[model samples]
Target: MASIRRLVLDVLKPVEVATVSFARELSDLDGVDATAVRLVETDREVQNVTLVVEGEAVDFERVEACIESLGGTLHSVDEVVCGEFVPEEHVAHADATWLR
Candidate 1:
């Protein structure tokens, strides 16, 4: 089986949990080399964030569990890269019609 190299997730977390702490915890996970969390939106109770995890072999189950432990909900998986290498994503002009 191929290893998971990267994962992009949409997560909703309680405002009480600081994004820095959340990101640090994820970065500490085994097989995870780094994590980047970007705030997408926020409200009084929750924060919407996009989390990107990159590593040699990211463990999805562990990532999910960590989010839940921090009182966060995984909204959706936006992107996933699995293989021996991570490739740069390319978008053709025709495929980006919505950008105009």
Candidate 2:
């Protein structure tokens, strides 16, 4: 079986609920599922919201569009760092230094 990696999307919007609704619509996509949905809170007004989605990368673009169509605009996408999907490997040392 093939394993899909996490796709991280950064979106900017006017309201928090708007972003949540966009994420909700993503769950209903043909091959998209939400492993996790996180909203980072800050005192500063939210100009950017990050959504981390776990699934096949093949469907990433379509899902991205769905998010945009739902009135949320995607600002950037970062491929999750994991062996199965992204080629890079992240390593932690005993001293807490990280290597990728």
In terms of TM-score, the best-performing candidate is 1
Q: Assess candidate 1 and give its lDDT.
A: 0.95
How many residue pairs collide in each prediction? 0, 0
Q: Flag clash pairs in model 2.
A: none
Runs off by more than 4 Å, candidate 1: 96-100
What TM-score would each prediction reach against the true structure? 0.89, 0.60
lDDT of each: 0.95, 0.62
Q: What does candidate 1 score on TM?
A: 0.89
In Å, residue 29's CA in model 1 sits off its true spot by: 0.6
Across 1-100, the per-residue lDDT of candidate 2 in tens digits comes to: 4545667777765564565576677777665556345665433545566777765543667776877676666777765433365565567568796677
Error of 1 at 85 (Å): 2.1
Model 1 residue 48 lDDT score: 99
lDDT of 1 by residue, 2-34 (tens): 889999999999999999988999999999999
